[model samples]
Target: MGMEDRCLPGGKHKASPSPEGHLGTCHLYRENSCCSPDVIQDLTKANDIYWNRCGNLSSRCEDYLQQVECFYRCSPIAAQWPHPKRPTAVLAVPFCQNFCDEWYDACKEDLTCARNWLTDWHWGPEGNNCNRECISYGQMYKDGKELCETIWDDSFAVSTDPCECLTLSASDTGFSASRSRHEDSDSIEEPETPKKDSRRSGRKGLCPGSPLLHRLKKNLRKRSVFMEDVEGSGSGF
Candidate 1:
């Protein structure tokens, strides 16, 4: 989208520099600021802080630059957005002593705001400032809002999925069909194996009854045989 079209309302954008205690967006001037000293100073200082903190990191500078840009972009919205919320803490300094941890935290905050704007200002059906097709829109968010043909066919429906959680749209019958096909494929690929009982795998025990009862039965049988033998021999006493 064009830069001018992407401009946020003045009330919604404002950033407060922490250490320097400065308050402003990257657009330090009301007019074009290509050669403005204030604009240049802010950019230089912000870059210095970021580079010092991230110099040792092995990644490209693209992500960092985008994050730094957020202060310029979103700070304006944070400042004058219709909502009466307090000014957002936009870090002017790039590098932190905390290093990686702090960078990750800062990036998340900026990106989150960017993502919201991507939907509300650009991708949402009602969006006038931005369009869903912008590369930056995809970079800032997962999936763009779903643009679906309404059942009536006279109008279209659109909704932004925060966090880009799901790719499927409610209007998509194809998604359901694809899901069913996948499930069928999975079933055909592998059938359930029958389970065996482990308890019956071993040999049977000698005593069907309790150990004590079996021992008693054997002793009684032996004693009766001995008595019968004694009675037959005339030693019944």
Candidate 2:
């Protein structure tokens, strides 16, 4: 997977943003994003990640996980740090101290068996299965920094300077697109309001629901092909 603009290969992302917000779980990337509505539906069904194998997580912990999922699955900025060989993966993604701390605090009580979720798990044709002893998150990583920096290998680089970091939130659009995360910046601008187009609102009746998802899937099947971005495939985040 050679470097590409705003989208890594082997994922259900747009070659470029489709100029409209998607519905359901991935709506955070609504403003000039990559993933589509069908991708959101696909994500909702992905229940085999090792993080959940220990048991259910606290709601607060789950929200943070959702935010991380939003970034890995939907955010266009993810493309900036593409993995060396995996077109569907990213490395050294810019993240903020506040988020890491908050996420660690939220999930510190949650149980996890592996230090690295990707490799520590036992993998097979079915899905990833736990391979190690289950223990509290507090016991696995020293702190938030270690959790973020170590969990996915070199996948995320945490920033101390708050303004120069990525939030993985709706406000992320305010973050300058052209600036490299490694560069110094003193401030983060406010997100600009997107002008409403009656033509775009409601997706012209393509609202979020199973009905819309089914319709989209049906039409795509009729085409007998997948979009190039959707062709990107990998094992995990």
Candidate 3:
């Protein structure tokens, strides 16, 4: 997506004022009423454990985890906003994009592990299914904000039901299985060679020929957003 397309309407400088008419900030409008702090805490711990266990496979994975934590920590609106508006959405972009560049750098040398981490975290048994259940909450938080800002600018007049927002279509999820498949086709230029090597090297470690490495390669690719990080740009939402 283009920079203009990714940003909240009216750009970063212009913010919608509060009902009382003060310049509204996310902290001022932060909504966590619907969130169970205990639930978020539990999920946070679960996320940490999952990443720690998987991090053993690649130290670079720690960088990606930082981005995940950033999203989880800053997305109270995603958890609590029953009806989200533009002001709140605009407040969330910078926080979410804060770690994008770092995440991209961490994944550059080990893209396979990065994709596997995302896939397994969301769909693997060890992920506690929180990837599918909780991460979407963060995405909803982002999408809701973007939707409101794009359509309404600084107006709080538009309100979106959080439940409806959460029920995103595959495309709306921002990353689709087909996209993963496309990456698999385009990125894995020599999968056959890797498979052959994996069959011969029964040894462990993240070596290209290892079984674990093979599985990482077999899993789906993650969003191209991380790839943007390679340029060290913080432009993505």
The numbered model that scores best in lDDT is 2
lDDT per residue as tens, model 3, 1-237? 322112122222212211222212212112211122332343324333454332232454443343233233333223222225443233222211212323344443332212223234445554433333222212333333342232122322222322122111111112222344446422332222133123322222233443323433443332344454554686554
Clashing pairs in 3: 89-145
Regions of candidate 1 where Cα sits further than 4 Å from its true position: 1-37, 41-44, 47-50, 54-59, 73-75, 80-237
Between candidates 2 and 3, the TM-score winner: 2
- In candidate 1, position 12 carries an lDDT of 32
Q: Each model's TM-score?
A: 0.20, 0.68, 0.24
Model 3, global lDDT: 0.29
Relative to the unseen true structure, what is the C-alpha lDDT of residue 227 in candidate 3, on a scale of 0 to 100? Answer: 53
How far out, in Å, is residue 154 in model 2? 1.5
Q: Mind giving the per-residue lDDT tens digits that candidate 1 earns over 67-115?
A: 3343343322222122233122221221222222333333332322122
Query: For model 2, what is the C-alpha lDDT against the true structure?
Result: 0.61
Best by TM-score: 2
